[model samples]
Target: MDEKENSTEVFFDILIKNEVVMETAPLDEQKEYILPDDDYDFHAYRILLLIRKCGIINEPFFSHFTIYGRGKFSFFDFLIRYPFYLKRVIEIEKKPKLLDNLKLRSFETERALSPMIKYIRGPWDHRYDGIFNYMVSKGLIKVEFTNFNKSKKAMCLTLTELGIQISEQIIKEEPIWVDRMDIINAIFPKNATNERIDDYIRKHFPSLMLGIEGE
Candidate 1:
């Protein structure tokens, strides 16, 4: 099959996997699309892959006010939750061909199941805190502080040596994810202000910026 057909088939597989549509029934027979909650191992693996590839300075923020500032926290959710959005961002920024490396296909299979993936938004998934806490308990990551301003230190999440070693192993197992995180990192480089990320999200995904209650 051609690439488009292959991508379509992959998307259908995702829908079935997520129970968005009945696997045994026709594709038209839809089910309530309840978002799937990722398991600890799944979240752990992706988080490791993210930190491994992006490194400390470019890590996704745990919160906007803490790392970035207002609306910037969504970048974390964007990378972790929205694969197709990441793909589109890379395409729009004229980065390297995405499918060329198939860097995010694993993520695409899980989160990019539909073309409307970009429009899907909700409350920040609280599962992240649990995942980070678990990783911390295992000594995979540490909380460090960087100079946010003259007086304040910004909290930075960084991988430990063990984290780095395991992350490398993850890379060896799935090299396709090599530079996928870097594409987003390059767009929001070290010391980039919250406004920069906030503005970008507002421009591209205004709907997402709105509160879940539509504030």
Candidate 2:
């Protein structure tokens, strides 16, 4: 076996012989470990910034951009959110020109070591609903249902005056996030539907066919 494979097998054999214990705590007992920037206010601010920059995004689109990073959307999310990891991917894949091709700068890529949110679906701590509700309560954003594609109602979030003001202030304070948003625009084509993205992902990452989304 290869050295890496041999080492992995040895590690698993050791793990089988040992019991690992993980510490846990209840909601009330759990202490805050996330940095101040990862707090609710910052999440709210990011939602506002997204709305301001991307225009009115529908629920599905919002989830795709923010929370849904599984299956078809995985690589796109990896590029958009885990930008530092993107550089590593380029290096490992030996696509040195990708860095310049994507117009990623060191300052922008250094903003995150990994994605801030864990992408999952189907009943986890889905932060979008809670944060949207909190923003609604704070009068920072309004949630409205609109007719989409002439058939279905789509729930959309729009920034209120307060949200806009706060988002603008955040933009002024930290413009690096604007570069991050630019990465999103660069990675995904304008008005590209999920089907197109799915097709592209399937073509590029054929292994994902085994674990199809929503299955």
Candidate 3:
């Protein structure tokens, strides 16, 4: 019929496709709500709202949709696209700590889903190197490539003073800053042991740990 009605129909189709709610007989009998005109941004927002109503998705995915729209992103794409988000999470405690590449890779692999994982093909992909190099060029972070006994090479990342200030300001403006900070604290507590990190991840993100072994 009209644009709103058309959008509602599309939304219903998505819900059915995802099996979020079963298709009912005579779909016309089902009531639909008015949505904004069939624009890409509005459509994406509507899909997110419907998914939330279905109670099927979780954080990062939820937040990612809110921030980046409906375009499916690889985990590397997520990191590259929202480097600041990851930076904010890593520096939530306001300390200039060294975040090793391994830790970053581990976090992404564990948290990102199948679609994202399949898209990125893991953290070692060249796409990730590009993102990091871009951040370096922007002076948002400092990277040090270290060679250990000429046998192993590792990259260490640290936020610059400017980066810290910018991240803090951005985090403060977030509506869910408090809740986000609490989650970060739980994930990376002070003086945290390997056992403690494992316990926290298992307790909080058990779904993410599926098929992933303890570190």
Candidate 4:
């Protein structure tokens, strides 16, 4: 983390950059992101979208997200939204494939760290752990592992080109504030669960995967 880039204020500025990009997007794509009375896609549309919009460029992206790191609140949520808004986001995935066990990384034990610090607070935990094992299983993400180490080892991660493309195409449509409102309305509506939130989300955001009603 760069000293000048990790502060909370820097984080908001990072968001401001995307917000600027968002302003350049076609107005037609800026429909209100209301939720449905029912289902949604929290992964493809949401996760990918967060990364695209929130580009993995700086530490600010996680400045706010680390707050929810103790829980599985999906930091990827705020990062991926507008695929067209970010150019560099698609660039990060251009690295070589991660040959599982081929590379390694070691994290210093931080008993002083909070629970949020241990986990990335997003879906990367599994990817980092199994070397995209499950992703390889699904054929969504692939990797080969070589060389093993146990005592005080280093764990290196290699993200593939497909991973970058996947990140771009899987982004969600809802912005942070919008999605939050949609979720709040869904889980805690004026009358406790309004169907309009569901209807609106479905109409404008047909690609979402996570259900908010029970959340």
Candidate topping lDDT: 1
| Candidate ordering by TM-score (highest first) | 1, 2, 3, 4
Comparing 3 and 4 on lDDT, the stronger one: 3
Provide the lowest-lDDT 10-residue window in model 4.
63-72
TM-score of each: 0.59, 0.51, 0.32, 0.22
Estimate the TM-score for candidate 4.
0.22
* lDDT of each residue in 1-215, candidate 1, tens digit only: 99999999999999888879433865688555543355566667776776656543432333221233223433644554566667667676787655454355564656442122222232244566687788889888765556545544544566777877888798888654555555666766645655676667666656665452232
Evaluate residue 125 in candidate 2 and report its C-alpha lDDT on the 0 to 100 scale. Answer: 27
* Whole-model lDDT per candidate: 0.58, 0.54, 0.37, 0.30
Write the residue-wise lDDT of candidate 4 on 32-73 in tens digits: 663321112333233333323332222332211111111112
Write out the backbone clash pairs for model 2: none
Our model 2 lands, by Cα RMSD against the true structure, at 13.2
After TM-score superposition, the amount by which residue 141's alpha carbon in candidate 3 deviates from its true location, in angstroms, is 0.4
Off by over 4 Å in 1: 1-36, 57-77, 96-99, 102-123, 144-152, 212-215
Clashes of 3: 0
